[model samples]
Target: MKKLSFSLLAMLGFFAIVFVSCKDDDNGDPAPLTPTIASITPSSGPVGTSVTIAGTNFGDSPSVSFGTTSATVASGSTATSITTTVPAGLSAGDVNVTVTAGGETSAASTFEVTEGTAPDVTTVVDTVVALEDLSSLETAVVAAGLDDDLAGDGPFTIFAPNNEAFDSLIANLDVADLTAVVAALGGANALAGVLQAHVVADSLPADLIAAQDYPTLNAASTITITVEGDNVFANGAQVIGEQIIADNGVIHVIDSVINVEAPAVDPGEPNVVRVVASPDGLGAAETNWTADNTYILDGFIFVNDGQTLNIEAGTIIKGRPGQAARASALIVAAGGTINATGTAADPIIFTGEADDLNGSVPDDANALWGGVIILGNAPTNNNDVGGVKSVEGVPTEEGRGQYGGTDATENSGTFTYVSIRHGGSLIGANNEINGLTLGGVGSGTTINNVEIWSNLDDGIELFGGTVNVSNLVVSYSGDDGIDIDEGYTGNIQKAVVWHTGSTIISTDPRGMELDGGDGPNETAMPFTTPNLANITLFYDDVDGSNLTDAFVMRDNYGGSLYNSIAFNHDAPIDLERLTTLGESSYDRYTAGDIVISGNILFNINGVTDAANFADLFEISNEGDAALETEVETALAAANMVVDPGFGTGATKFTPTADAVTDLDSDDDGTDDELPEGVQNLGYKGAVDPAATEPYFANWTKTWAVISQ
Candidate 1:
């Protein structure tokens, strides 16, 4: 009887549990559909307006209705978002919107559907339509078969050649039937490419080209822009018409046609000496040039006042490194044009050793030497000078300059692209010269785009000259990269110097070096101070590192450096007077005159103070906020380049035996030069751990230090 009663109780408990469970399963209350309405760009979206909805919880396939009218749902993956093109017959009124997701719909939301406006076409963008104005461009394009390519979906940049440009291209062509230009292009396929040649992908407004470089789509080709006295030209073709509206692209009418260089067959080799001097006379020496950032010639170079001796781009002139004529490669008389332009890739190079061969070892190939010089209206601090004078406001020895004519306007020569590498050879080690030694370089001299890389001595040691240069790169010099003792008032911008040794290791500040106390006398440069703007440097101090406080602005060193940066140095910044000046008015020049602001100085050598650090800025401004601000700004712009792109750590030495000598050192030395049983070939500077360690440093001098 008791068991029966327990069973009845259990059955009743089970029924109660089932009822409770059923009630729990019945979640009739739907999840609170949180509604969020993000704004659509245009409240009154046009009938065909492709609008984006910005909101939350718009579940996929949510039905968005325009009032009572059912609109075709476009995209609905969120409860708070839905996109539907405006249906026809919509008026200005608040339309109800609801989002439905997972068999559930959200509460009605409000959206404004206003009367739509007509679609308007703003400015049209064009693709690849060459200006119809170019006289001979059409002919060349048809010949090249670029017409169709221009008509295609592309914005090409074509270095269109004018009538004269066409003449220049076809002058040597043996094909007689010039009328078949289009036919010879292999049909419309070629036409498209031909026309495409006249178009740059980006529509370059004619005004943006100001002695600048622009990239083009053509393979290994770029549009050469020349702005001569406001006359703009592409590929030497005048822009007759511009901004022609078209569906494809803009059309700027030009006067000429551009031509691509054809491959030339080489003539048999003859005398290498004649080839150096009379390069163009023999054949196109443009191929396989021997030098860098410089040109060589066996021909007579003529220069007249106002006239220039402009060595065109990529011209190389070899200086006999082993042979007898290794001393001087090019000698520019006082006047004439010297427009030696060299690009970083193909700098006009002038070297002594063979192009691909290694530099002469020791007393032999020391930068088989040659250099470039331009005489202008400037002063000189030749060896015979009495005392070092400030180069400020001092019209340097303009002797033999202004060769073109009396008018400075006519005086023209440019050295936009040039690199004189391995030029400064040792007449003797102590009395070695510089790479680009300006004797009387004047203001008229076009001295930009000049570089001196891997010189045995200082990169650019100016004797006396007034030359303005921007974008000059000086790297890996045995001596200082630039040593301007004598007067040189030239503006330098975007100059990058990567020195492994002393960037400016002056022997004597009394030499009138601006780095120490370059002033008129005691007054510095009377009233004028030379300027150095946008100067940046990264130095790698190898053996026998000369201490440089970035720049040691001394007594008469007056200049303006804007937005400059210094990195990886023993001492990053210094502004102080190195020598005591005379009682003359030249003494008036103080370190305060230098307007240094918007600069950055970052010391990556891990030195905090001058005492702890081998060197840092030693001068102070007595809490001057202006000076401090300049100093701080300079610091911010500067940083260290940890990886010099060279392999890290020790470099390999030259020995083929089973030796366990280390191929590295703290000072970047190789194992080959280690003192084994072999005679002391001495320390060879391996600046880069990757490439065969170059003999960059005066290895003998460093070896002496190591030996001690």
Candidate 2:
């Protein structure tokens, strides 16, 4: 019996061991649960308030914290819900609430600590000091001893540069910090002058500021406020942060410091000559503007019939700031000529009076003067008396401003290596002059290597002309970069358009705004078909700004877009078919009249399918089988990825050899193939990547305003 009992005990022990081993193998201690806070009741409260936190996977004995302070977890807390009391001595501000359970912590959500009462009125100084980003600026203001003036009740508009702006300034000056900045300013008086330059006596909102230049506390200096698209800029500095409101004034946070200094004038150069003309206009004998002198147009200056206006290279011409009747412009009449052929080394410049002949002009200084207008005797769509039509920006009584004729190859004289800036003055409601107005300029004219910067209107407007333009750069124009209207049949090649967001007044800024004609006659004779090639458009994606399409074709406009690279634009190509205006761009493409090939688009918004624009191509001339194959092949080739190596310097658009080879091989449709002067360089975009010679090296290297 004892032996049997011992054997039974051994068997029982063996069974017990097996059970323990199985339990250990199948499962260890329960895995720790991660706490989650799905919802916090009330979201905000004072200290010691009962708050219910609900979520999942909450283990027992969960601890809660409001910001850094620990909270008391109440009893009856479940895995999905917990009740906790807010910690004491918590400050009134935004605090993150987090929960921890079973050695794991959950993510946090913000909880506001409410004061529940009206706070004291804050001054501008107080607001600046309160912001962490403006701490450096606050210290500078205190050092300048202008804190009392800023804190006073009198309203002021202060352009406050943030800490980053100060840091950049310090770096630019080769200094360490704010202390170094103050020391570099020489003394407290010099520092005060610099600070006062940012402050205006009146409280000006964005709209008011954009209207006109405001006098600042700095003597004999003014701050030019500009609005580009949805953004507001003071001088050249962009306003980065929201406007801070205070009891006495408002503060606009900028990304750069505003330094007001008189533009240094050359001692040898003659004093500025104010060309205030009479009602009949200045005679042709006194029309010679030399490079040794600076010419300022106070009113309308016209080059009348049988006259030539000879301007030397490196000549600086300025126009007085005005609008409507007081607007000033240089007009070359129909029979008149302007021999303004500037070299690549010394280009002639037309700018506003505010431009101090210094190389730099604030990008925001626009619409402060009128632009250049050159009228030629070229055929146009809409012809009035004697095959002519009144120009848009000029007055109706100004008969010399009319442009049109039967001549298709009339020369309006030479306009090369010219920089037109701060133009597009408004003469009437919705009527502003373009930067370079070529009204019926014929084929014989030489228009090359021209740069238009910060014009309040279109960069270059061609009205029913056959003038081919090459090596053009248009940047920050208020309207379209290159606008072709009234049946213009020109060839534009090697053009670079940097349309930064929208313009100051006009919201619809495009790389190319092509229109056939303003008419019931949509299919005008020329059809406004310009053979455009090797164009690069860079569109800035500004938040809350109006849509700036790379290309906007409307009103039966049919154009050829070849070997182009459009990057980072909302809509790389936008086609509008106004039924009232008749046939559309798609219609032209379907008819094999509009050629679009070897084009690449990168980072374009809202492009999903690879075959998005495939409908515009003629897939086959024969059967369904051929159509399917051609469609697939063309779509794949057109949408292929090719990176144009964009850099920060003058050679920004130098592409790789592979990218160039891939982009250059598009020769189909139309007998012209390439434009008259453009060479088939076997590369895409404006620059030839494989060439030993640099593209636009001669023209845009140092002379162009945008290059500077």
Candidate 3:
């Protein structure tokens, strides 16, 4: 009996050890403790007030709640503290603030909410100083000694750059901090000029800002407001924070600095002077510009009515960098003439002020200032009360800026052997000034041997103009190479567009963009029936992801394309005719109103079958066989497989002898049938390969910026 009792005790001890091991295996790890809230900063004020919560065990991704409302955690959330913003629509009272982290809740802390009042009680300076994000800007204001002016202003619209903006500017300037930034801006006086550029006398909200150009305290500059997508930008600086209202003004937080100074000019440079024109417009005096001096345009210089601004050959005009409202441009108003006739050896040059004339500025640098604007009294589709309409990239309220009248034979001026480079400033949402804007220019004007390079917008844009252009060269344009809109009935001959690609931030890039009219006015009178002949468009080696098209024809456009070559484009043509417009490009083609014949499409890439090129067009099968045969015959006659020796300079468009001789047509190199208004150049492309008078070589070689 004693031995059996000892055995039972041993078995019980073994069972207890087994049970303890099983229990340890079942409970692998210990659970975390609940978080605790210690305190909050300043309690709270009202909605949009930033509050800091101090606590313990608040893991990464904590959820904070103020009473029944949720608080937004801004940044810098740690286990010890969490920054948050007070939610809106909360009543003024003491509320309990609780934090939850790692699925664990914390105790509630008391937070007092204050009354929310209108922002009119505070001044602009006080409002900017109160915000932590604008602390740097506030310091700049004080350093510039303009704090008192902002505080005592009657009404002002202030574009205050945030701390991040100041930091970026400092880094760009290779400076240490805000103090260095103030010192680098040439002390307090220069800083004051920059600060004044951001302040407008009127209280311009987002809506009002998109409509007009507002004058600022800076006499030489103005602030231009633009709305792109869903956000607002002031002089390319995006508005990041919410608009703050004040008693005397409104504060808009920007992500970038506005109105930064340009590169300093050398004092020893001959004939270099900064001329700031008045915003009201230039006088009607007869001004003669000589070739000896360099004219620097500082603002919008509009030659009023009865003015004749004569520019001699070899004259160089430099436009200063400024906002859209104060962009430097030579505008010829109605009844004003700009006789800028330049010879090929000494062409008239219009460029940015940054260009040192020593080839320092690259060809891709664009939008440093505004371009030339010539407004005349020609007929247009969309007319105002007195057959006049406001041109784009100009103030609508300015009556003198209006173009369009009933005179289809109106004369503007002459532009020959001129080169416009690095222009086209953005004026509004998707609205930029083109390199050469011919608005309602009559057929009496003479425009020949023009070269536009590295323009921020379209190279040459015609708005309901009857003018004819010849020997045009456009390269590296930010937008389309050529844009014809409204009821333009012009004729373009011997034009060459090379390196056609979209800008870095562009949405649409095309070789040619044609629009008959705006909106539902598809059948607008005198349709966009421009005659284009001997045009050569060369595409860059751009990726397929870019929005690049050879031709974009929309609305009720009626045009003729003859003796043209479209080489290596993503999309050869895109016909976008809204169903509401009632007429389409296909319909126009069927009616024989639009002509697309005698054109050579070579090495056409992107989503197209090279064998059957007719499939690219949206026309019906009524004349499909005939159109296909014509295209094939043209290709064979032009010897499309031969390489057209394209050089690397302005006079590089000299084709080989075999490329010029037509095999099927006349065999002497001329087309069998030429269009009514087009001239038979005896060549397929813009350059006459027969060694005759070449368009680009004879015109653009002397003064155009081709390679260097």
Give the TM-scores of the predictions, in the order they appear.
Answer: 0.40, 0.59, 0.64
lDDT of 3 at 582: 63
| Candidate 3 local lDDT, residue 426 | 65
Model 1: which ten-residue window has the lowest total lDDT?
A: 243-252
Candidate 2 accuracy as lDDT: 0.63
Local accuracy by lDDT, each model: 0.41, 0.63, 0.64
Which runs of model 3 end up more than 4 angstroms from their true locations? 1-270, 273-275, 279-281, 383-387, 500-504, 542-547, 577-579, 606-652, 657-677, 691-708
Model 1 clash tally, residue pairs: 115
Q: What lDDT would candidate 3 get against the real structure? A: 0.64
Off by over 4 Å in 2: 1-269, 383-387, 502-505, 542-547, 578-582, 606-641, 663-672, 675-678, 690-708
Q: Per-residue lDDT tens digits of candidate 1, residues 400-471? A: 322211122222356666656555433322444456665446666667666676555566665445566665
**Candidate 2 residues 454-473, lDDT tens each?**
78778888888788888887
> Cα lDDT for residue 659, model 2?
60
For model 1, the superposed segments whose C-alpha errors exceed 4 Å read 1-268, 271-308, 322-326, 343-346, 357-366, 379-412, 501-528, 542-547, 572-592, 604-615, 619-708
